[model samples]
Target: MDSKKSIHLLYAQYLANKISKDDLALLLDQLASMSTEELALLTAKFHSSEQISDLKNTEFNSQKTLAFIQDKIVVEEPRKRNKFTAWNTIIALAASISIFLLFKVIYQKDSSLFRATQDSSLSSISNQAYLSLILPSGETLHYSKDLQLLSNNSLALPTKDVKLNVLEKGQLAFEFSLEFIEKFKNKTYLIATGSQASCTIRLMDGTLVNMNGKSSIQLPTIFSKEFRTIALHGEAFFDVSHHKTWPFKISAKETEITVLGTSFNVKAYQSDSHVLTSLSSGSVALDNGTHQVKLTPGMEGYATKSKGEFNTRKISIQEIGMWRSGFFTFHEEPIIDIIQKLAQWYDIDDIQVVNDHRETFSGSLSKDKSLTQILKQLEKVSNSKFEITERRILIMR
Candidate 1:
């Protein structure tokens, strides 16, 4: 039988409490191998089917099944050779299944879950925003409003301030405020923000990082006694804690920024051709392997992918990290670049420029404004027309 049919049969057996251990393992393995699109389709099919509904109403108990599955996962995890990848996939599968089952129960009791909003399409787009935490053991944890709801209702997820400590041997330790602690650690952890989403993280040593949309940062759970180092992709504003004995370092694409204690903004998205580091306070040294430059407050250091050399220019201190303050500030930025920024913030996929306008614009706009409102302002300033259809935008000049 095909994979979907096999999964359907196995799931039905599970709901009826008749699936064997081998079949349950097979089901999870197959589900893990499927792509996100495939899994979503399967979920929709399962939810719409009368057979599954009948089984759920009559025979299925979510709590018992969840416990059984958790036990199976614990038993099977040790058998996998590539534990990291396998464990992450298994955890994601478990969460997906748990949420799917739980949502069914919640929906039956509360139809308010499906209530429509005025801007349903915009709501759908916003739903795609998320923050992901990848632990060293390859376990991935996701945080979002929707996931928070599910977690609050059923999952024992940690809420509020939590500290992470990296332990030896792929173990991670979580220190929760309520004196709840757990041992799960690795040397490094990755924090990522999805499109249209931003997040702030406080490092163990009191460094504050404000991440932009579609950005990622990788740092050790605990900094070494000598120095603090972290890798960055995309963009972030960092407020480094003053540690007189230890220096802080950021590794971006083709550039390394070292400082004692200072506030700075770094934009190094891999898709972009240039890496930019703007200093707001104190001093920082930027090295791009071939060349090095020191930047003081009000100075911006940039390196192009083609030249891969450090270049410095003076920029207004107020222009640094404007996004963090709910504003988009552009200073003679190319029209395409401006549109791309909007696309990243709005999570819009389809963008078309009707004419090849090499116009550069300089202005500031509030992020609180709607896409249409912002576009209208841009049209007035740049003498360009913007047409929005759903999540797609067209520009003409």
Candidate 2:
């Protein structure tokens, strides 16, 4: 059952004076997960119900409601210390009282909402745009995508003389020099893409890395004698140079992808629990020492650190690195996972899913369109409804 639906049911039962202590505890936990905007929406939605207005006769303990919500936030997920803000706690408490009071009205007037599912809609919304480049000197440059790179040597960045050559979108070319090559032999630099941005980088080794939005890669100034290793925090499509002796290796959390010279896409964000690697051509080995799997063209490899399991299955060739190519491939994927992708690409925070979404959905969306345009397409497939605010997105059912 959806957590939000469970909360409504529990709220109804509580108003009827029949809720158990366990149900109340669960309700508090669910409420804590909701963002402040969502809580406000919940209160405002039922505030207008005629049935609720007549529920003034019902009595409730305000102090106990506040206490329960506060206690839950403190102790519920001790490991998630960064999950809550001071303002969110205040919103939760305010929501708790409003929820406790409004249920009497909702139960009496709008009981049908308990059985309601989700609907999605889209309106005009805007996303902030900027990309981050961390130099070897620890200085950061937050530049817009339209800004061109003026320097001929891509590796000679973070310098005042660095120039911009506004190349066409999705174009990546790296011109190297023996002097510049020697300069970056052992040094490392970082590149990060924003919500509305994508970048193609040519490495010192002639390898091309096409980074998707909200993705990052850390590359060395020079490849080691034995291996060409890079660390990835998000998603990227790699076109590696063929080196029989110096194989390309990518580290994403607990998983490592190794290939001699191949084209592959890796989606392994640090925030995500599972790391996904899809090979378009050439053979690649996904290894974490304890478990290893080899992927062929049109093959997808999935590994979860928690389970410590590596699994492989065949997918379509088109699905590999579709985002960079301009589309999203969602197959048996959760709505939350999809939203996380949007959050990263859009540079959005405060995404709230009111209900538990155990259902999986499959489809494709174009990346060329705006956020609202893509969301309207999403509404046709999912049971959840979308409410886009100034920057936050609220999902309800």
Candidate 3:
């Protein structure tokens, strides 16, 4: 057999947990000697094969295999030879497997493992620690003070000797200090939260906004007499003050939401495939130029960028602002999607899903919990296992 076919056979045996020690050594030797182009072709073949589909159900301990490969595979340095080593071969194999698993999970269809049911018992997870103020001039100001100060409804600014107060009902009243009023007036400001931070701000019109982690809201220092408009780039809960004549408008990617007065949640993250607007009270209209839909209390409207059309669904009113109270509520959400949310909240830098069964999850989790705690609960409810190393998280079945 050709070297390519031989390598494929060995890899298949390895996956089946049927490879002998001598065969494993021979496979590593062949992989280390192969060129980059040849390795790429092998990876492509692995990706297209049906063997990968059976990975999720395999009983082999991949963690132990990886550990053994790392510890046992060592190629002695040669005086005048190619640079490839056993370590390089192991890394390449590991990367190829990871890529295959991720692609399979993301694109797999007609698989029962993808189906998920709701679990009412699960709670939520936690967030990062910094908030920032970006001025229109491009200067970014970091809030370096203790976030706990906000709990007392007043934050003392050590840099400016001013008190930034959180008004009743969790509204961050920036207008309380004359210094802030003078500085922010007439200029546009972008309030941003870090990967593990959430913020609440009171707009000039008394509209309360609770911003989720890794989110931002851009607004002028003052609203125009005819309209109150803001642009959102992430998720937020809005409680708009009543204004019959002046309409509150929000531009979230392709969707534009118009409201006279209402309390609702807008999840418009650029990374998300859809812009979701869920209402808790009053009424709001969602338009994306191509289509328009009006939402009443307990209704949720969503639009995708690719389709540019609006769709509506019914949700519990209590689920509207669950994020504000440090909880995440999901309904038949994909596992990858849930991990993306957890990555944002925990400031995780890298994510890898291996041997994914394409499972979906539904439930609630408290944001106050640790990453380990959240993943433990998730493991109990699903067939996946989670591993964390530094800032990276790995999901496997």
Candidate 4:
């Protein structure tokens, strides 16, 4: 049954003055999962309905329950119908207050919520956060979930210039030392760009780093032919400085790659539980803690959640790295999963279902298009309908 329809049925009974106390408690449980956007549209649709005021009378610990449910930041609380202290009890008792209050006691204790970690300390477990970064140079940088800092070699950065500093989270800026570069090969300089920014450092050793946005890199304000190396987090496109005798080492989120100067890209976001490394120009060996996979250009390596399950396979280069072009393209992705991607992109937290498993979809959807337009196209293909409320999308069957 549609939970919304069930809620309305219960509300209708209240308005008709025929509802027992238990049905009222059941409705409160349903309201807890309602997002702020859901509540606004709900109130708008029902404001003129006579059931509105009657439902207001349905009390949770009297006035306290009302205040809690109506609070702007209410978290979802699953409301299942109580098996006991329901209409059966109402019928057993001859319309007495004694039986009704006992029903409230039986129901209220279980629904009480104690928020253990408030917003400030919830970063570790929370998908949402108010992240900001500050530079040692006193500049502010916006933070992205996938941002990395790399320190290796740069034309301008004297090899391993330890003094280079990143001022903020999303800002890309690096410095090179001329002292190390004065005697180095190409006499190149280090560069830093912004979110989704790219840094291409042409070192004396002829190596490169394509820093993806929200990424940073530093180098030897000097260069060495013996060993070419750098560290990374977030994502970066790399074409290492080749040296047969000197191996280039790249490190990120508990994964490392040592190569004889090859070409590849690592999209290892610290926020991501797994690291995705794609070979682009040359062969590179990938490592998770215990397992390692070696890949030639055009192959990909994935380290799974379980420690021993590292997997390596080949993927289309264009599909995996399309975000560099400011878009995400999906192929053969499930309709529900597609909606989920949209939800995260728009920062939406509400996605309701028609509770069916057989529906799925295809076709290219734009990230820049409206949620309604995308959903509408999907609905047309699946021969289904959907309801949109502010940021939420509900599948209608």
TM-score of 4: 0.43
Regions of model 3 farther than 4 Å from truth: 1-129, 144-163, 176-186
lDDT of 1 by residue, 240-285 (tens): 9998889998877657789999999999775567888999999999
Instruction: Provide TM-scores for the models.
Output: 0.58, 0.60, 0.60, 0.43
**Per-residue lDDT over 203-234 for candidate 3, one digit per residue giving the tens place of the 0 to 100 score:** 87888898888777777656777788787877
TM-score of candidate 3 versus the correct structure, residues matched by position: 0.60
lDDT of 4: 0.51
For candidate 2, which ten residues in a row score worst on lDDT?
Answer: 116-125
When summed lDDT is taken over every stretch of 10 residues in candidate 1, the lowest stretch is: 112-121
| Tens digit of per-residue lDDT, candidate 4, span 273-348 | 6777888766888765467778886798877764455688877766655555555456676666676556544545
Query: Residue by residue across 85-191, what tens digits does model 2's lDDT show?
Result: 63354445445655554553343343222111000000101123345555444444456566443222245453433322334655543343456546655555566
Of the candidates numbered 2 and 3, which has the greater lDDT value? 3
Measured over all alpha carbons after superposition, the RMSD of each candidate to the real structure, in angstroms, is 16.0, 19.9, 21.5, 22.8
